[model samples]
Target chain A: MHFHKYEKIWLIFGSGSLIVFLMVLGFAAFWKGTHPQSHIETIDPQNIEAHEAFQAENLGLHEVEDGKYIVNIVASAFNYDLGKDENGDIVKTIRVPKGSSVLFQITTRDVVHGFQVAGTNVNMMVEPGHISRFETVLKNNGEFTIVCNEYCGIGHHLMFGTVEVY
Target chain B: MSTKQLTFSKQESTLYMVFMHVTFVSLLIGGLMGLLQTLVRSGKYTLPFNIDYYTILTVHGVILGLVLTTFFIIGFQFSLLGKTVGISKKQLRAAWLSFWVMLVGTVMAAITILIGEASVLFTFYAPLQAHPAFYFGLAFVIIGSWIAAITNFRQLYVWKKANKGQKSPLLAFMVTINMAMWVIASLGVATAVLIQFIPWSLGYAETINVLLTRTLFWYFGHPLVYFWLLPAYMAWYAIIPKIIGGKLFSDSLARLAFILLLMFSIPVGFHHQLTEPGIDPTWKFIQVVLTFMVIIPSLMTAFSIFATFEITGRRKGYRGVFGWFRKLPWKDVRFLAPFIGMLAFIPGGAGGIINASHQMNSLIHNTIWVTGHFHLTAATTVILTFFGIAYWLIPHLTGRTLTAKLNRLGILQTIIWTVGMTIMSTSMHIQGLLGGPRRSNFSEYAGGEQVATWINYQLAQAIGGSILFIGIILMVYIFIQLAFFAPRGHEEYPIAEEESDALPTPKVLENWYLWVGLTIALILFAYTIPVIDIIKHSPPGSVPFSWPIGRS
Candidate 1:
């Protein structure tokens, strides 16, 4: 019950800092609409192709507007099914122009995986049966590697892709 | 109370010693696994004997994170109970049963992991299932801990009944609070294991509900860290003060912190699931708020610790603002090790706040920064405090003394550990900021430019880890010395007394019904709606995938 004068002062300083942190977090989450990659819609892991976004024709980048795009990806153990390019080659590196706003919509068929465009704020936990989504503008014209941060399986480290912004 | 009254009985000492023995063995094994992990990740050495990297990673996580911490905490808490409130013969017998059950379970699980059947990592997220025996073994471990928790509660309950109206001993009350939280929180994991994992892994069920199982795990997972933490807090609050020749700064304040931790730790597991899908962001935000509430108690603890040092030093005629800090016993390992633990928590606590910050979790969520954060918090702050306790506790129990020579060795060991962790954790944080992922084996990532940036940090981690392995070797040597080879003498079991002029601790602080009731209410409020939403709007369950990681 007895708080030394210094103890009280320390408590005030500590609590004040914590409160400031909470206020900033709240402003980002509630006011600025900053949330993690949580999408409420459930997709069937076994039958992902049945879902509109995950169908073969829709698995890669599609420009919804001049500078806005959505990339649908299906993550599996040891691989990211990033759809094919015009030359019928698997799209390992996604290319977009600088200043383009891209929304990555991803899900997994087996086990939990991670979708993180390294060195960017685009990170998400792609779980089975749920679509994880993160939208960010390609501000820097550089190649960002996409690595699976979650331990999906033995070849977890081998699972990586690239995003090039020109 | 006389020293004789507080001393553990011969049988009691043996029981606690068994736990200590298991703890040290785990430290060595787990420490080795960690060293190997760093070496492998450095992109220099490959694991020989066809040993998979994930297997060793699982070993490190399970042995250190689960086995070492659990055995040490339960054993240490039992000793606290025996010292503070006399444990009956019946309670002692039950404690032994708990120990055996836990040991058996640990062996079963350990063998399974060793033989390459359960490399699912310590978290063991379902759908990537392990062997059924692994699940069974983990279940037995939980049940065994339940026994220990029950014994602790009964020990304190008997004491309260006999000495009606008297407040319980501070350490005993703290032990009870921790046990109560453990029981309540572990129910989530226990349910997942018994009902979901066991059935699915055994092929009785065709598929496992992924989100449901994870929700249940994190329900227990967040509190799992606090379970490792509160015991260290126990030593910091009660024992460390006495070691420093000071009385407890405030009895009520310490009790209040424990109560608050119990309340806030459980309901906030959603913070871990923030980056995952299926869970609503609103629930995550709410739990994030609750997680921040838990920080209040830790902040209070920081203040109390500083105040205890300053007041004690001033009493010894130290004058300047920082003179009190200088007055602390730097040469004594008993004080020095835990002091370093306290120093580590400053950064560790800051990292935790950032990790739990709603959207900010994206910055380091699954990155090596999170790994660095915990190494500082659990591995440094908590483990170092345990070492500090061991320097005296082991000798005190074994009728031996921490010889001045061994004390010097302890100081050296502490320095080695500090240097090693600083280098390792610092590099981890830097690499994580540069987009390095955790829980992966060594990879060049096809020579990507960003991947190239992480190699130097990885090499630094390997160096740091090798040094840490050396520290572990020294610690184990010191443990062996203190347990058997130290000089035979009475090493005082220091328990600080409440200051004579301090205000009486409020009766409400001891009101278990009120506290536990509030704890339950908060957990329900935080969990119920989100949980229902997860199950109601559920995804189709998936069959097991054990090909790459686990044996069928």
Candidate 2:
């Protein structure tokens, strides 16, 4: 097929840009080890408690090392179970020291839910029977609201939590 | 002036008009639902009459996104076929059958959603199941669309057989590619519905494999957007050149773009599921690569369009590198509307790339930004072009003329839509970056500080949505005048011609078996392994939940 001179030039530029984008994404994935929150591990949605990490006592934040932590969360309709505070009240807020690396492992017991720390680069689609995980360093000190970005149910808007780095 | 006017027969015209009627009514209803959503999301007003926000959201998505677009596209495609390649009486009969079945399905789905039985939104993700009727309704809609696809294919086949060695008309070729893609891609969702959703929703099954259902939906879902878009591309590539007083830039380039789009559009569904688990990152990256390959055709399309404009303008005695741009018919709604649509696609296309990027999807996944992205692509770019088509197509089909007054009103309507969309979509993007969610009703998020940051944007969305509602009202009025009240006269069904020295379109591009074979091969390559992995190591299925919105 014949291409006009200018058309050929435009295609080169356009295709080059797409190639550059793909290269950058490849670098991020293969070199930097960047991936979306895909865990590829499954657990029973109906019997999530049977999974070790999802058991009530095991859920929520755990200090794995100095300046490092892991938070296991169970998401359901309009709720994010972030374990409990010392007072036994449902832990609605998770506090961590600034400059800490945090890994969030989350799953939903019901429909598909979205776990997003608003105003940050932390997000995952928390689906039943699969674990969705995202790890990021808390470089900034502030309170970030965690919201369900996916439409789960009627009270989808009601689902939320908080992450405080200090 | 001795050439005969190309027009649809009266029977063909009447059939298309009926489709247009459904299209406009859907615009009104869906537009109203959209207005209500923005209002409720603003937290300034509550839905009265015990109505739920999710219901209206579902209505807005289904009616406008699915119903209006499908009816307009199929109707418009039929006309294109009728004008280019004669539709057989048998084919016409089949076309009408498709229309009725689709209409019945639409009514069933609409009534089910309106009564709040299926507020699962347009994706209708599994586990959050809708009523059996809703699933059946959607199945019928898909089946009906398949019938239309077969009819379109037959229309072209008959023409090709009689012509013996001629290139088919460009628009008919495009319509066939689109329907071919639609039929093949929709099979994924059709299978999911028939095998998974219908039985599960009807309580014949105890639980659903959520990931499996979602995968199938996105397999269809990604191309579903392209299905909305290719028709607009049809207008942009073929129809717009005629409206702009230019020949096609290159017939070969346009065909190549459609062919590329068909090959790359379907196998990339994993990009939508990038943030989900149970899918390996390798496969996700593979599909993401395929997704980017789809962009090349669009890039080609952009070049072809610009070349068309420049060449046409230069031919019109305009001189200077950019003078051709100034030579376009700014006053004509048929050109202006689609031109604006073209302009919107720049940002729309850019945002689409961002959304599909493998890891970067986390930045905007499920955020209102994603919503904003589509508002630009589908709602503005595609819908505006469809509006542009309506400005003439409606009148052409109805044997009426678009009076100057209506044309001016159309310009005003276009302006209103552009402004409204800019405001709403911009605010949606910003609020989403600030971490606001899409498809959610109003909430302060327990008075969180970030939630406070989104309120002003929500209010702006409401203001913008209200303006869009007014634009819709104006559009409906213009449709009425163009359809029934305008002076009876001949309106051209503008189809652009090839330039005198344009290269012959390669016969290889028309080899359906080769293209379709490549398309399926790519799909299987991208999806086969990952899909098998999802099923093999599957998580336990969950029973259906309908307490919040779906029927019990």
Candidate 2 local lDDT, B458-550, one digit each (tens):
999999999999999999999999999999998888888887777788899899999999999999999999999998999889889898564
lDDT of 1 at B332: 96
Model 1 segments more than 4 A misplaced:
B1-5, B550-552
Give lDDT: candidate 2, residue B23.
Answer: 98
Could you tell me the TM-score of candidate 1?
Answer: 0.99
Best candidate per lDDT, number? Answer: 1
Stretches of candidate 2 above 4 Å error? Answer: B1-6, B550-552
Q: What DockQ values do the models have?
A: 0.80, 0.82
Error of 2 at A3 (Å): 0.7
lDDT score, candidate 1, position B310: 91
TM-score per model over all chains: 0.99, 0.99
Model 1 lDDT at residue A47: 94
The sequence of per-residue lDDT tens digits that candidate 1 reaches over residues B191-230 is: 9999999989888999888999999999999999999999
